[model samples]
Target: MRVDIWSDIVCPWCYIGKARFERALASFEHADEVEVEFHSFQLDPSAPEEPEPLLSFLADRYGMSTDQARETDAGAGANAEGEGLAYTSARKNANTFDAHRLLHLARERGRQREAVDTLFRANFGEGADVFGREALVGLAEKAGLDADEARRVLEEGRYADHVKADVEQARALGATGVPFFVIDERYGVSGAQPADVFTRVLEKAWEERD
Candidate 1:
């Protein structure tokens, strides 16, 4: 079974969804046979190249007060805690285009999942500057990838097309949100669902394999 997940790095729910999906996979009888791929999807492609206060960006984007946005962040943080993710509020917003390109680079080295988890933790847990080249190279190294290769990939603007293709594929698949899970490209699960839901989907996909 293959599961392709479309999600953004800075997305709160996507982190929670990843934990839940991991839990499901852990208990799956066929876990060893399952293949999971994480795809690129930018929640804000037009977001500023410079980092900005997360609270301010949320407030402006949703037309809500800063307090409301903070409250929302707190809510997401609490949910993340339930899954041991320890998510923190966004202190800075970053353009994830380069991050997505780095993801493709990591995928090429067969460390895509590790890169995904590392990037999520760095951005959401540690509030690292994911948009910066230095930070990305560090994250890539942490994921067991070559730091120099990662730097070259970012420098040469490599894998940018792969990121674009993933985004386009998501749009063509009628997805309008992050954390969208496509099971064998046959079933779609949206949002951060419970582990049971993913487990059920896994079973169903296993039964209907072609």
Candidate 2:
């Protein structure tokens, strides 16, 4: 079965969904036969390359008080911890164009999953600036990619079209959310569903494949 997941690197629920999917895959009898692909979906395409403080953005966008934003972040942090991810208070947001480009490069090297995991950790756990070429090169190197080559690609802005195309295709397919999973090109699961839901979808896809 082929599974295509559309997610952004900064999305917390995407990380949670990844953990849930991992749990389901561990028990899947046909896990070895499954192929997974990560596709790009930018949550804020117009966001500046170096975004302002997240709290300020939230305040301006949602007209929320600082206290309300803090409370919401605390809740999100707790939810993230439940899925084995650590949440920190450093507020930084940036355009993820380069991050998605690196993902395509990782896919070409057959290390897309590893790249995804590292990217998530670098962004959420370590608070690395995902939009910066230096950060992306570091992440690629950590994922076993050649740091020099990664830097060249980032500097030249290679794979930008591929990332944009994936985002456009996602919108054409009516996906307006991150962490959307399409199994076997037919079964669509939106959001970070429970592991049981993923397992059921996998089983059904496998049976139909036969």
Query: Which candidate's TM-score is highest?
Result: 1
- Residue-level lDDT of model 2, residues 1-210, one tens digit each, is 899999998787898888888889889998998888999999988878975666666677789997787787777677788877877646578788888999999999898999999988877787667677887898899998899989988999899999989999888888999889999998898999989999999999889884
Best by lDDT: 1
List candidate 2 segments past 4 Å from native. none
Task: Provide the lDDT at 27 for model 1.
Answer: 97
lDDT of each: 0.91, 0.86
Candidate 1 residue lDDT tens string, 150-190: 99999999998999999999999999998999998799999
lDDT of 2: 0.86
